[model samples]
Target: MENISFNMVFTLSGLKESKVNRYIYFVFVLIVYLLIILFNVTVIVTIILERALHEPMYIFLCNLCFNGLYGTAGFYPKFLSDLVYGIHLISYNGCLLQIFVIYSYGVCEYSTLMIMAYDRFVAICKPLEYHMKMASKTIGRLILFSWSFAFLTVFGGIVLTSRLRLCGSHIDKSYCDNWSVVKLSCLPTTVNNVYGFFVILSAVVQGLFVVYSYMRLINACRKSKENKKKFMQTCVPHLLSLINFTLAILFDTMFSRYESRDFPQSLRNFLQLEFLIIPPLLNPIMYGLKLAKIRKVVFRHHRQIEDSLHTKKR
Candidate 1:
């Protein structure tokens, strides 16, 4: 009989094995995560409750909320534990799951933003047919396909990634991640690395196409200064989303090596913000502020909910 040894990869290195800083960072992330989750949840709930918000944009907003949920699902629990208890130990299985969740949600988010971009593009670029083009059935199918594509793309990476054998368990981030886990593999990581790179490139390219399409549509519709301002307003969420995703890619790529002892944990923490902090907070605020219709409907919905609850209590 032959014996096989399984080694722990992606273990913490240079980490003080102390609970102090890890717990502090964890608390910070926990507060941020809760805030983000609460905000996104409120947006989703408001949109669902208000018939006035039952439109293509709000539908896409719901999808974005779920994307945030899924993203936080991957990182929050571990992050919280690391914050309060300083427990960074994760089973190899757990690490893989984290990788899958983080990337899958990220891909889904990018796709959802693209769908929203198209919605805006149609609204501005082809206003006459916007309703017909963004019909409920059509929007439903688009959301379905966006999630499916995200699943398929991240699934490829997951399959490739599963092939690596962990030689040690020293991962070099405040959270579990794909590149950090993969960096610990003793086996040949060539295939997984290439697959990951492909995923990153795809996200970047698709995200830009979304941004460009929306901008072009906006420019085409800008016959009057007022119309131009409105068009730009409509594009704000998409622009912020695109920028966040782009910076994420750049930071992830730059720090992919994980061998750079020079890389500050603060920088790593900031990179984490792109995924955890920005989209959830910014999406709802941008939509509510810039899209007058959404703001009005959301406010109306909130009041209605309050009234209904008050009546029930009475």
Candidate 2:
């Protein structure tokens, strides 16, 4: 067998067909990335600066936005540079780092959402005990668990991938993914596959936990109009964000594992990038619009700014 290349750089083939429109694509993506940053940051700052919005639910929302920003930073900068320079190559270490940031972002997202679900479950199902159950210490621990669990889980996969002797350096997708890297290995990847499936199973279990929490919430809300109102006010935004993320992840997973070359290049690219593009953009928007307190705070801040500017102009 030929010696595996440790220093090989991977070529991202997703941009091959878009060379003609790379400039246009770059501008569009840049605008989207900027908007994502702006939207998420707006809410995050609002939560921090406004003490009223510093409850467990809002804290989790802030963390969610932070995770969105963290995840996108891993992809957008490198992607924009690739578009401008017409280079799609990433070094081996860079590839693994990207895989770690992006996938850990994803896992952290699910973990955060799961916590949000539990928060809602407590707030609605056990309103009297909600304070004790989701206190500052509890919320802090949950946040820590979310980040640590995601980092460790994805870290294990990255470590396994780093140990592999790679046979090829070309990645058909726009970004570095754990599965894609494992597929490039020259030898059997049984361990990686087994661990990968375990990760998937863990994520599925998280999803189910969120689902079960919501189910209990629905049952609890059925008895009281006030509970139903709270559910509509707070839980609806979480549900929308959850649905959006689920679909994006589902598309990327299906495409990465079972994609066909016969699909249109643009569609394929969209599938590959939907999670990065949609969730980060949509999560903040949904929270800002649907959550009453956030919406009111954001608009009030905008009005205050406008009034201050008008006074200066006058």
Candidate 3:
């Protein structure tokens, strides 16, 4: 028995959604949000300031952090307000915007990683042409393409969604998603389904491209110790980031498609919140700590700041 929603406001019922001791949730979310901002901005600023880190790999890593920031921006603010007020209601337009920003961020993650892998592949397998292949102009084009591709792809879905007349306004997740919204539509979503399949096809294609690139990289790495070291230093982080994001999105995909009330609310909450929480918080940290040049520059800055604080204390 589906509840018929008369108007545009959608109710989100994911997570504990507790009014009791909600200040605890507020504080927790606030701390995590602040940490995300702090760590991501640290990596981004480090890349900007360090001349030694001006390579295409670092540039794409910076873009990954930017995507993380973009994605979290859609979630943390609204979520904090919800925690504070204990309200889970969102306007139809706000929900759409959330879906766009958050899903675009997800898509951007895949695209950013794809480009990053390409950068690594060229650098490792064709060192002589790396400069020619990944020049500043080329880099700019790729970044633009990554972001533009994501925005346009997600926007296409949003456009299709806006025309639908919803039969139910209740979403069983903490945030709005395109599928959740589409499920509410009383009209047949045949076109939407086709477009959705297209989106999946596109993603699958990207995944295959990444896998092929990595296979080539692995073959090149086996040829020399230096290549292996470089791969371990740079490529490993990207792989981990990819695996992290893949799992998070996988959880979300499963949750969206197979939602059931019999499952515990906590599990459902995790499915909804995993992508929003872990990747945004960890991606920068992973890149920051694992990549040698970034780690060096970061630690140098930390030491310098610590010394300056000690001098002030004196």
lDDT (Cα atoms) of all candidates against the true structure: 0.73, 0.91, 0.89
lDDT of 2: 0.91
TM-score of 3: 0.95
- Candidate 1 lDDT by residue in tens digits, 1-314: 22121334345433353566666666666788888887778788877877787989888988888788888788777767655655567776677778778878878888888888888878777889989999989998999988898889877876766676666666666566677766666778888867877876877787787868866876786676765775667777667876776677567657656445575766665665466677776776776677777777777767988999999999
Mind giving the per-residue lDDT tens digits that candidate 3 earns over 67-183? 999999998899888888778899988999999999999999999999998999999999999999999999999999999999999999999988788878888788898998899
Score every model by TM-score: 0.86, 0.97, 0.95
In candidate 1, residue 260 scores what lDDT? 58
> Candidate 2, residue 114: CA error in Å?
0.5
- Deviation of model 2 at 195, angstroms: 0.6
Candidate 2 segments whose C-alpha is farther than 4 A from its true place:
1-4, 17-20
In candidate 1, position 82 carries an lDDT of 55
Overlapping backbone residue pairs in candidate 2 total 0
Q: How well is each residue in 1-314 modelled by candidate 2, as lDDT tens digits? A: 44445578899975764576999889999999999999999999999999999999999999999999999999999999999999899998899899999999999999999999999999998889999999899999999999999999999998888888887888889999878878888789999989989988998998999989999999999999999999999999899888888888988888888878898988989988999999899999988998999999999999999999999999
Query: Which RMSD values do the candidates have, in order?
Result: 3.1, 1.5, 2.7
Q: Determine the backbone clash count of candidate 1.
A: 12
Worst 10 residues of 2 by lDDT: 1-10
